[model samples]
Target: MATLEDDEADIDPVKMILLDEEGEEKKLTTLDNGAAKPQMQKHYIRSIESTVAIRQLPSEGLSFQLWPAATTLVTLLDGYLSHLSESPLATTLTALSNGGDNGRKLKILELGSGTGLVGIAAAVTLGANVTVTDMPHVIPNLKFNVEANADVVARRGGTVDVAPLRWGEDDDMEVIGREFDLVLASDVVYHDHLYEPLIQTLRFLLNAGARGGEKKVFIMAHLRRWKKDSAFFKKARKLFDVEILHTDPPKEGSRIGVVVYAFVGKN
Candidate 1:
């Protein structure tokens, strides 16, 4: 007993049908909260993937002031796994990328870790001990996210430590005693004004070098912009033997720029 109005409504279709990861057909939500959150908040996730190797980032307002960020994060970790010959970390460490040798249990440090995605991914992927550090204001979310990723750590057989570190602070470094086998930073160079202090922190955390004394490998992922300074790369090079290991364009015809820096600590 359908009326003309009912037929018209059916034809119009209030919502489009969509499929979930499991391929269940469902109506697309008109009010999609998953797109992005505006509030500065934090939420937990018990799981992320079945890889048995990946950390889950807390979903709520996790201070991601950086853009092209979530995807870029995936890229950084992906690069870490694939940049076999490109990465400048300890030879033994890089050798483990293929999971051929999971013997490496490195002490890693991540600075300016917005939500600990890059560091968490590394810890999960490499089974390394990761120390994720950011400013005090950013620590709570970082800690929450790390906890959210507990399953990932447990499955991957690695540990992630969250801590607070301020840029350009000497006393802080003296207290923390930057001792790490690998150093990572992602999307941290957006603020040209804060570059020097950020670089200083990197210097403190990095291991000696591939020469095998104190320093170790350091990797930084960034989005290149037309307005960015050419000297930025030069400055990093002057401080350490910096090299370009990988560059990935925006994903799937998307408009985003990304590049990773592989630095060999100078003796």
Candidate 2:
């Protein structure tokens, strides 16, 4: 895992180019962590659809810092998933919202859950059983943040768990047995070196649906930082059916662009 410094403004990303089948070339956008302070700090995220306040403890490593892609996903979940609207994700949301007394909770696994913002929002607002995972070094603060909001999540009939997952490790994969309806990741493609391991993890989780299990869906919210970042998407398109659900410019006039994608097994 790479460590990011307190200030990333001067860190120019590795330049790369991407071309489509038609030979059309497009510039890749640079990623910005966005106002992330590398210090022990607490953050408050308010739900747009409800009065739930998600508490976050961002401490220690770069993985603990809050990122904009997490915020975008949280906002999307808070604003859109709250209602029982007619969308591709509606069935999953319905299962989550109705899980409490029905004894059938919609299980969710969040990979690279920095600060656990999006997962916490899902637990507290949607009452889904969410397992938030990240690197081992970042698990302490991640667990602390989860415990700090345990009561809020429990009160809403949801539960939060934390695990240490280092992408392509066999032990980590053994620990994270495949049994989730939805898999989530936000802004995890910043480092080009991690593309293979990250995609491997996704493949493992997505393949859990084989063997007569329920269909699984993967949703990722990404902030494109450079043209090379598209490499991950290109690699992923070969493994799963990918769809762009939403797109928006980075907040506060950042040069990067944000897009949310939903993926399902091709079979």
- Backbone clash count for every predicted candidate, in the order shown: 7, 5
lDDT of 2 by residue, 137-210 (tens): 78877887888777778887889999989998888998998987788888888888999999888888888773
Query: What TM-score does each of the candidates earn?
Result: 0.67, 0.75
Error of 2 at 228 (Å): 0.8
After superposition, candidate 1 runs with Cα above 4 Å error: 1-62, 65-70, 73-104, 207-214, 251-256
Of candidate 2, the 10-residue stretch with the lowest lDDT total is 2-11
lDDT by residue (tens digit), candidate 1, 48-108: 3333222222243234433343334444455455543344433435543333225647777
Q: Give the range where candidate 1 is weakest over 10 consecutive residues by summed lDDT.
A: 8-17
The lDDT values for all models are 0.58, 0.69
Q: How far off is model 1, as Cα RMSD?
A: 13.1
